[model samples]
Target: MQVAARGPAALTSGRQRPCRPACAGLWPAPTGLSARCRATAEVEADSAVAGWEEREERGTRFVAGPAFYRPESCAGRDLAVLAAALQRKRTGRLRVLDVMAASGMRGARYLLQADADEVWCNDLAPDAAMHSTMTYNLCTAAAAHAEAANAAPGTDPAAANSHASNASTNGGSSDHSAGSSAAGGGPVAADGPAGAEGAAARRQAAAAWEARARVVRLEGLTRDVCEWDFPPLPPASPDPEAGVKAETIASSGTLGAQPSDEGAGTSQPTSSSPGASAEGRTEERPGPEGSAQAGPGPGSSAGDAAAPVRRVRITHADANRLLTNCFMREDYYDLVDVDSFGSETQFLPAAIDAVRFGGLLYLTSTDGFTSSGKRPERALAAYGCYPRATPWANEQGLRMLIGAAVREAAARGVVLRPVFSLYSYHGPVFRVMLRATSSAEWESRHYGFLGHCFVHGDNYTLGWRSLAGAVCRCDSRGKLRKSEEEPQQAPADASASAVEGSAATEPEPSASPDEVKAPGPSGAPTPTSTPAPTPLVVAGPMWTGPLHDAAELRAMAAEAERRGWTGTGLPKSAEPGGNRAKSSRNSRPLQELLQLLIEEADPRLAPGFISVDDSLSRRLARPPPRDALIEALREEGFAAARCHLESRAIRTNACMEDVLTVAEQRLGIKRRR
Candidate 1:
């Protein structure tokens, strides 16, 4: 289920997979599906979209399909579960948030599929608006696929039935109390005053909102497909006679959504803000009067006027400000996610206050450490959670605190569920998701940890339990685990090997006191001889040659020192008689490395040169020396000359591969070493 690749490969399905992009080459396959179903899942062509949707409607919830975004934290399991939860909880329309909304792909899909009452989407950058637009376009494409599939002979049955059911359900609508303010229709007005100018502004805003909303609805088309129609956004409504104005609807662009029913307009679009620009790239939408109508596309006005409803506005202001000022009021949000990248605990109490009673505060704590060079217990205490270190052998100081917090919350009648988790690529960063209940629990549990820099340049969990506590507590085993575990031992070995191979060379470890050579021989003073200092020797010319430029050479030596190679003996000529000896000593290792590199590349260069392991193998395998690299280098006519230089550098203990790699990097060569 886990995939790790150091390079790219062409799969049997003809997808070019790149190691960096990670998921760039995968085609999601459904489990428990027959051959027919599996074939249906590989519906990459635009033509197959319709058929795929038809099959998807009948597929079980567990069925995995090709996803545009399926990373651990961004998409895949977490997103799927979230979507299903939204659907199950919604009575009429879904209220959703796309937090870290990158390009709005996920939100756009939701708009296209779910019957959302309102959706709010926000991002850290302005360029995200373009992504929002694209997501909306894709959603439209998905919708079209659904419509087309249903229109087909056999696949159409399920869609037709669902449509009929939705229509009937929409017809008998009551007040949707359970949904957010954006969902159930309420007051609809501009935040400004009522006047000629106000009305014009409202109209402009509405027109813009509708325009972007329509773009979100047009998610069915690929970039190649042309749009059909676009509805103009409506204007904002004026304030009441008492000078009270309501909030306007959030932009569909924010969340990249359209009307859920496609036929009805009851759902309020909240995925994105109206200020976003779609750049006019959506499939055609049928206008009110005609089957197909279009204008400047995403910005065009559909030319319709209707009074709007009032709705609670969604904005991206600082949560601390909102909560402290009481602008949004307590119990305003059913679910509030304060996903601060560094620390979410600072806003925990405020978030808990914002959510309604029995609501969920999905908070993330990425700062996992304790004070005084240990894990603190205050994190769990703040959230009404208690630690239970079962199988005590598996418990660490920091982990115990987390477990304790959950247990404490449970004791206080707070249903705590530890959900999805992820570790950063280097394993230094860890993200944990927890669902908390009750304001008291949330307030009490809000805490932070101070990290400790341990020996060997490693960071170990350490923090104070609380203001009252002196230090964090941990068992002897936990301390040993922290200090003794050779977690980085393998990586260090790999690095050593890489260094050795590049030098055509050799390698080491361990030491003894006798080998170390203590000061005295047989407890007697040992005589020493003073050696003459070597003079400097430069490689370049007199005026420009580094040898003559003492100052420059000194500067170079200082620079090398800054990079951890401390010493004053950098210039070969700095020591007169020993200049060549020192240079040879330094250059010899490099030559050895180059030799090793040449040896590694030899099989690829010479057709008849068989690898010793390859020769001994009983099974048939491709020639060991034949490599794509050799072919690529030869195609460019640099193979023979470069190989000769490489071989010489390896044999002479001079640096070759580094130089080659530098040249390749400088030239921006796509080929890998």
Candidate 2:
């Protein structure tokens, strides 16, 4: 109830309670805190909304004090950790940089779970309170890593929590020093004074701020989380202009617009852990033979359990500045994870630039509305392509995001292929893991426009240069209406057989060479009139390729099982049969989701999917059985697979006509009375 009273100031003021504070200084606030934040603040768990507290994920503990952390969205994190671990195995080393690391959870896990050699965790906070909270978590995470590394073989991994407990209870070494800098400071000079003295003061202050940040990086404590070197506030003066100009120092914080969050992911954290489970999981990473090293390079490894210690540095800067600095310095990271609130389009170029050759870029987008065609103009501005509503809009959201990155990389003569793409309903979040590649297809056919025809409930993918003279065959409300001349109607009784016959008899629709030719037969210079237009709700220049890299998904699933995150890492049953196959083994949501995504990678399936409950599927007398329909699809030699974006939907190559036919004959879907 006191949220309005507390606002952003509460977390920044040391004297005030740790009521939820906005990290506004971390980024600029042209308007104010986001609506998603407001709604989340309203319904947050009673334990969390009040302030700093401990939370556990993937066997690592971190504090959630000033930044927002939702347990529901941890599915994305689970996959990332798996990928980072794989990267380490492939390259023999992994260095990570996590930007916007509010609670430092992801970065901490990178060190503990992925066994990275080093991790730079950043949340460049704008105020003292948020900074201190983040510092506490980072220090505790590092210390926990140290203890876990030193713990000998055959010891219970859960016993490792005691070390972090001691660190927090002991006051983290510099609590008083940190508090004094933030809670008690002399009035800062508001405006630049005349001449040399003022200039010298500003330089001294900037130098001191740098020194402070550097120390915090090395030692991980005593950080107050304010702007580096700049005056914390607009100044203790009445000059509004001075305040406005003062913002230039931290301008990188607001480099991009406020991103849309995954509204679905913000549900109150109720259960101990909603989507993640620890059935076969352990907190320990054993070394070769039996003895584990506590440090990397010479000693322990950077993995879950008390494997070893890795170099970890905590930073508080906007994402762009951090990545850009790396780019300029040619100091690239093995993995760069940017978990921004909304569309990650703004950071694509810079993110690509900062990654070492062949490294991965894990991107996210929560603007489900934009991809669903609610904001075409905004989508264009962000992804360099427009989004139009379609039956598979959720999947299009993934394609839209990938297409943008592909193009961005193409501009630099590089290619990126999806290691895996995830669409979690929790936040309606769209996440994609892309890796630089060679021998992968990025030609025009793989990146083109997609069209959905309302007239026939059909979808098409066409190249940008080939849109001319294209026509929808069902323009006349007739299947494959090959000629303009109206034809005789068929009897009602034969319609069923006719419906099922097109799969074998008629060819799929395409630009008719005869109709598309100019008026003269000899290829005249110009044509007098053109064929009638067929309207299509179109979305484009997006990735029309496979959603997941089959090899990568398989490896991740195997890794999940090896790490005890899942039991089999395989679905209990996903057979293309009549009965719905059971999901993954109990308490393994990550495995279940991964299996569904794996199914979506079939090359035979096209760029669209149909909801099992939509009118197309209802064309049968009864709602068709999902597995039976999939089996029917394959029996007729058509491709079919379930899409993870929606539970009851399938992506297949067979046209709707064949689907209805197979439903009628194989699935026992009777014709309507």
- lDDT winner among the candidates? 2
Give one digit per residue, the lDDT tens place, for model 1 in 152-261.
52332112212312321111111111211122111112225443333333223322332332211111111111122212112211213101100110121111122221
- Alpha-carbon error at 454 in model 1, in Å? 14
- The residue-by-residue lDDT of candidate 2 on 472-560, one tens digit each, is 43322222221113343322222221211111111122422122221111111222353554556668879877788765676677766
lDDT of each: 0.25, 0.51
- Per-model TM-score, in order, reads 0.29, 0.62
lDDT for model 1 = 0.25
State, as a TM-score between 0 and 1, how close model 2 is to the true structure. 0.62
Q: What's the distance in Å from true for residue 649, model 1?
A: 45
